[model samples]
Target: MRSKFQQRRLFEQTLNKIIGCNLKALPTTCLIAADDFNDEASFKRLVADLLAYDCRYFMTYGLVAEVLHDKIDEVISDLELGSKGILTAAHSDEPIDEIAWFFVNATAPEEDCVQYFFGFDDKAAFNELSRAVKKEVQKLNAKFND
Candidate 1:
């Protein structure tokens, strides 16, 4: 198991890669947060800032597996309501709450646009990384918002 600092560093590194790769220019980056953490004013501000860049998706990552799973299920249902259910059905698996970070490029012609990053399982590390990510996001908001 990696140390808390290492885990947090991993989060920072992944975020930097996302930013450096010009994913922001593509404007498809969606910083997903669980509803438990989504109520924060700062988080809302970040989302608003990202929206200005033409990013349309704001995925809600529920803190628990069951809630996240249900949310995806509901999404699948909604998608099925339109065209064939085949596309959304791919995500019908169980909700995964163990990830530290992930990225998605919604504009891709293919559905395999999501890239997942699994952080250390240490709670302390996760908490530290979350805080670090929040701070970085807040700082980045200034650049994007302006």
Candidate 2:
């Protein structure tokens, strides 16, 4: 098993790559910069609020690829679209430990959905955030699927 530090490092690097990848492909997105956030905690709170608002598709494309540590370009490429877009990403000095996000539905208007991004500094916080996100996503999936 990877140590917490290793995991955090990998998560930050991969997440930064994912952000850059998507940004290159879709430059005109409503990309909110890291400087906008006061700290990691505020960012987490914002993500949680956004997730509750409308972003429900916890995409595994970037995340799964990161965990496997392969096919990164291909995985990022798979995220490209004319309508849907990544909502937010990590900023300078703020290394993200994990990311849980909702994939935009192609059939719907972009403005109709809200996207969420989260980052963490502490390993324990990351784990807790992950669990919370999972539970929320489950609730969201049930609501949306119904």
| CA lDDT of every candidate | 0.32, 0.29
TM-score of 2: 0.25
Best by lDDT: 1
Alpha-carbon runs more than 4 Å astray in model 1: 1-23, 64-93, 97-146
Worst 10 residues of 2 by lDDT: 5-14
Whole-model alpha-carbon lDDT for candidate 1: 0.32
Clash statistics: count for each candidate: 0, 0
What is the C-alpha lDDT profile of model 2 across 1-146, one tens digit per residue? Answer: 42221111111212223333221111121212221223444433433333333332222222222322122123233434213442323222322223322222221234322233333333342454445444443433411110
Candidate 1 matches the true fold with a TM-score of 0.33
Error of 2 at 121 (Å): 2.7
* lDDT at 31, model 1: 34
